[model samples]
Target: MNLDQYLPVLLFIIVGMAVGIGPLVLGYVLGPNRPDDAKNSPYECGFEAFDDARGKFDVRYYLVAILFILFDLEIAFLLPWAVALQDVGLAGFIAVLIFLAVLVVGFVYEWKKGALDWE
Candidate 1:
């Protein structure tokens, strides 16, 4: 094979690498060199770190996070389904209905179990 055919590919690879690394190299060369206690200290949520870094968090925190992710993913699926509604026909509509019903049931179960309670 002629290597000339690969010239564009090689140029693309080199340019991609330069675009990715150029800013980093320039920052390191031109950025500030000062470090202070406040700048170097570990900061979190507007407060100083008071607990162990590996401390166990409350299960409610995880529960809420999981619920958020579940609904977020449901929205992701919904956007695509809506965009393709004309192409999916009745069968796809029914399938999404069932999916939504199941999600509603789970939501109700979680509500009754007080999993959504903050206190």
Candidate 2:
């Protein structure tokens, strides 16, 4: 392989790295070196931390968050599929319907099990 062909690609990579790291390096070298008691404190809100920083949270919060992401991504798949509906034809349409049906079933199951209910 001719190495000359890769010169532009190598330059692109080097420039990309410089662009990514240049500002960070500049900021660290040029930034102020000021660390007062308020800055060094564990909590910076001028109030002492009443509880441990690593506190245990209710699992439901994570469960709901995960469920939200799962459903959100699944719904996102519909956007491109909708845009290309004519090209994908009936088969794609039916496939999306089935996908939506499964989503509905999962949502209904979660709802019936009170997974969506917050007290």
Candidate 3:
């Protein structure tokens, strides 16, 4: 088979690699060499790193993070549904309504259990 068919793909790969690596190489070559104590120090924050990196955190951190991801991804479904609203008609509308109902129920459950309370 002729390799001409793959010319665009080869060019795309080369360009993609250049775009990804060019900035990194340029930064290493041209960036400042300043490395003072504050810059080089293990600064987790202005405050010292109190907790061990591997220390067991309270489950609330994971719970909050998972909840954020869940709601964030739930919104992602809206774009496709909005685009295909006419094609999907009533069935799609009802399906989304049911999905929303379940989400609300879960939210209520979490609220009742005080999982959403900060303090």
lDDT leader? 1
**Candidate 3 per-residue lDDT over residues 1-119, each given as its tens digit:** 99999999999999999999999999999999896776656563333444467766678878999999989878898779989999999999999999899999999999999999976
Off by over 4 Å in 3: 1-48
Candidate 3 colliding pairs: none
lDDT rank order: 1, 2, 3
What's the lDDT for all of these models? 0.89, 0.87, 0.86
- Per-model TM values vs. the true structure: 0.63, 0.60, 0.62
| Local lDDT at 12 for model 3 | 100
Per candidate, the number of residue pairs that clash is: 0, 0, 0
Highest TM-score: give the candidate number: 1
- Output the worst ten-in-a-row residue range by lDDT, candidate 2: 42-51
In model 1, residue pairs whose N, Cα or C atoms come closer than 3 Å (at least 3 residues apart or on different chains), thus clashing, are none
In candidate 1, what are the lDDT values of residues 1-81, reduced to their tens digit? 899999999999999999999999999999998977777566644345444678666787689889999999999999999
